[model samples]
Target: MADLVAELAAAARNHTALARRVLSDLEAGCRSAPECELRDLIATSRTVPPARWNQLLPGARGIYPDACWPEARLVVEVDSRAFHGFGDAPERTERRRARYASMGWTVLPVALRRIRTEPEQVLAEIEAAYRAVLSRRD
Candidate 1:
């Protein structure tokens, strides 16, 4: 059983790496018009996960976000339908979002379909969320 579990873990890790690579490739090819404010930010950013927030909230499990744009006061979560709403994922996501909100961070949940079908729109929403955070900060 232990060996089986280990193998499953390895497979999960491999799959995650592949997904990240695909996202990176897609992001790299993203083009923005001159009027878009988030082009630079989105283009330069790599995937930002929750481990980056460990200093802010220690000893938190399953609390990692897809991306954490600290300067922008944003926490981006990529919600794939299969992984979401299964078991306790919904509750877990809510708990994490609340925790981040308590720390004055704006949470942005982006669906996988949106990432694939309307990346530009997703980027726009992220920019708007960041802008809202800035406005609140001021």
Candidate 2:
């Protein structure tokens, strides 16, 4: 899908600015709107470390996090109530987080509402988590 966009952008004669931006975001592994927003925030922030979107972490037991700084062993998951509020989804999320924790992965969960309303705070938390994890390594 991203390849198609890149090709289209390359072939276009004019007005490819938005397509280029979308292609860049897609290349950065952003699969959702929230992930793209986070990617933009991280990209623009000097304090926050860059993270790969929708990547599989090492020792994650097949779980692909929404965003991750693999070097710092930190993961950010955007949890939306629409997805996790039903049945045992919340429990499953908790269990998955526990698994990550047990494997030494720092899972930082951000609510979808918070992502929309408190982006700065979310970036702050991500910076804090990255610092905390790196500090522990040192």
Candidate 3:
């Protein structure tokens, strides 16, 4: 059992490394936990999983969403205080979300603080956003 646990840990480390590398190449990468990756993996069967795309939102040019399910027209934005949570950053983000909404993208902005406090709710909202977009598509 110990050996199996060791192997699993090793595999997880390897996968996380690969995931981080891929995310690094993209514009909007998650600098937090493996939540973004988990969402991608978990979204497989139930919905179109998100991936690290250099250009996630078309016609937006420099805007790169953290993760997006293009088929569902959904985008996930993770906010970090260290990066975009100070000064006018919050306001800028609100404008960005508004712009994305104008483009008909259902944006889900989750704060790192909120994720730490209400993780389950954040996950539930993500799923709900997926369902909302999915229903809109149909």
Which candidate gets the maximum TM-score versus the true structure? 2
TM-score of predicted model 3?
0.63
Candidate 2 wrongly placed segments (more than 4 Å): 11-14
How many residue pairs clash in each candidate at the backbone level? 1, 0, 0
Tens digits of per-residue lDDT for model 1, 1-138: 455445555675745765444444434332222112223336543442222322233334455555555765677666665656799989877888888888777778777666667777777777677677777778
Candidate 2 local lDDT, residue 11: 86
lDDT tens string, model 2, 1-138? Answer: 856875885785588777777778888888877777778777777866678787777765578888888888888888877666789999989888888888889888888788779888888888888899999999
Task: Quote the lDDT for 60 in model 1.
Answer: 44
Deviation in Å, model 3, residue 138 alpha carbon: 1.2
Model 3, span 35-118: residue lDDT tens: 454444434434435555435487686788877777787887777786577899978888888899899888877776776677
Q: Which pairs clash (backbone N, Cα, C closer than 3 Å) in model 3?
A: none
Residue 135 lDDT, candidate 3, scale 0-100: 85
* Superior candidate under lDDT, 1 versus 2: 2
Report the Cα lDDT for residue 1, model 1.
41
Root mean square deviation (Cα) for candidate 3: 7.4
